[model samples]
Target: MNTPVSALMPVGWGILLGLLAQSASAGFIDNSSATLTARNFYLDRDYKGESPYPAAREWAQGFILKASSGFTEGTVGFGLDATGLLGLKLDSSPDRTATQLLSYNPVTREARDEYSELGITFKAKVSKSKLSIGTQFPSLPVITASPARLLPQSFRGAYLISDEWDGVTIHVGRMDRVNLRDSTDYGPIGLASPNGRFRPGATSERFDFYGGEYRPATNLTLRLLRAELDDIYTQDFLGVLHLAPMGEGTFKSDIRVFNSREDGRAKAGSIDNLNVGGMFSYRWGAHSLGVGHMRQFGDSAFPYIAGGEPAVLSDGTMSADFVNPGERTWAVRYDYDFAGVGIPGLTGMMRYLHGDSIDLPALGGRDLKESSKDFELAYVIQSGPAKDLVFRVREAFYRNQQDAGSTFRSDNETRINIDYTLKIW
Candidate 1:
């Protein structure tokens, strides 16, 4: 396959890749591997309050093929990677659409019967540093891909990583387009807003970021990052993760902070936000207990990419982000590993979150509050024919006390996924 961005990328980078490719050796193909994962996913959502669409339920099958080639044997090596995805709808209707399992069918006001996507990445490595161009899957505090539905989100960009520094890693990227989890085409990036969609004319063609992670000790990690969505907003993030021994158990602490402001022309309109949150958990044998808290302070809500996953805070759950102007959230959770009870490969989790003090002056705000209850159970086959097969069930009960006239409604959501992977060499 040809490199999709070979002609669009800068000449200097192209020269480097050309040189590396010319030196290709046996390692380029010897260490290659491919895997295909088959996923059966179903989602059901029931609206709680007054709404035209009462429910949205859909089921689909997805196929994802990931193939990667090893770098050539040299100080400067080259490689390529590709991901192919296909989604087939099994059950859907026009009345009960918008389940995010497939693309929208405007003609029938229903979900499409099928959709597909392809992504390619060209890479070159020099010593311990590597640079990738074309498609990216970033999981960072500033920008991340959302994989909540039948297929995962994707972005077109260039990413670089360097790990030559002792105990430190550096990340830099320039993303230009985004494909939402439910979409098949990549397009301009937009800012996520308080009301669940991007404002009119609020879009950017590029996203730039630089970040680094440091590990000063075996049990501690620190990360700092700065990112900008051109003409829209700029955001900064700092996070700390630590682990300690606590009375026969281990205590884990996670703290994250985000500061955002309008950038350039401020297409998102005068962004100002500070999002602070953390999740702390203690584990003993097979039981884990955790507590989390997140709060948004400033004139505007938290800043994030539309349809992107910002998992920096514990409140970023299946149904709600708990991110609004003056919103503060508190959560508690419990988890158990069934292995302690003789059922290896099984796990369960329960969590509850309460959010209040929302500021929505436009809707009279009116003591705005929201709450969510979540449960998850997962199991994986340990041995036998289904060795690596996985089964997962997730449910969320969410409600908000928004204004009566508001279209936002309380929701009951359920998701089930069964997955199996096959290896091909």
Candidate 2:
């Protein structure tokens, strides 16, 4: 029998009170907010040497509803937050399958139509510290949430945050379950041991973590973090971020280092990594130009999500921190605001990324190179009958260098999206 939504109402109400306490000091209830978005995506890939899957195309639509409120009057304030998501298929087939929002069930080998989840958090505050429990989406150095898909990924657990120190903020938490991007069910995040062996049946009911950030100056910040993926691995991270004005815009630099070692019965190996990257941006009128470089060290790839490991030298997000394993990447990007050009609510972006010195041991340990370029243009109706409506177009081209007699091919893709957001508070 399917669980009824009513069964979850009691837990939802409890979480509302906790969240309100955290937002109480700010004053004023948020009232309520909701936004509906739809996307049409088309993706294609042609691999020269491998046949992972055939070229594919797909169209999908999604909707998101978010509601939040302020806490009740008192030293210990209380509030609630909730989100609803839906995704529908516009076009797809077995031969042209895309995993954008739908995944094939392993048992039945059928595509699922939709995925959804509900999250609520309860919060209480004292002085400058706040405590929360229940389901929440947290984005930290060690435990970042994924919102790139239909619904934002969430975790089931509790957390606490404090900002009492002059220039320091501290966070501590424990997470038990995670809802993946393609599935509504929550599962435990598994960790691999250092010795290249799998620790079977070693599951963590919850993972514990603690971290702090301190800013000694106006343009500099230092961070330290520690997390224990119960029975999997214990890791520590240190990072420094600095920002300085250069001409009209700013120059930002980031340096991060991580040390990971096996814990419990998996303490046979270890990973040490260091990442260094910097970006320089200049804005004149409505146009902005940016250039960045990032490099990685150590044998293992940089860690991001709790259980989902990233590929070495893979640029996971636009953050530029995903560069992995004996790799060096450089990117140049430009953004223009049409509003400054008298066309308000219009903007465009273009970027090119080139990577070299990729060490792929599986491909006979040969050094490889790859490059990709992406372009995006978007416009939003600012006012009038169609206010808040948006339209966007994007395209990308990817190419990989190949040796003589190699049978590799390049890939290209184009996508157009139009969305209208209606506020129903």
Q: Of the candidates shown, which would achieve the greatest TM-score relative to the real structure?
A: 1
Give all candidates' CA lDDT scores: 0.84, 0.62
User: Compared with the true structure, what per-residue lDDT tens digits does model 1 show for residues 323-402?
Assistant: 87788999899999999999999999999999899887665563588889999999999999889999999999989887
* Residues 374-409, model 2: lDDT tens digits: 888899999999887888777767665543222233
| Model 2 residue 26 distance off true place after TM-score fit, in angstroms | 14
Off by over 4 Å in 1: 1-24, 194-198, 364-366, 404-408
TM-score of 2: 0.79
Off by over 4 Å in 2: 1-49, 107-109, 190-205, 216-218, 259-261, 267-270, 306-322, 401-410
- Deviation (Å) of 106 in candidate 1: 3.9
lDDT of 1: 0.84
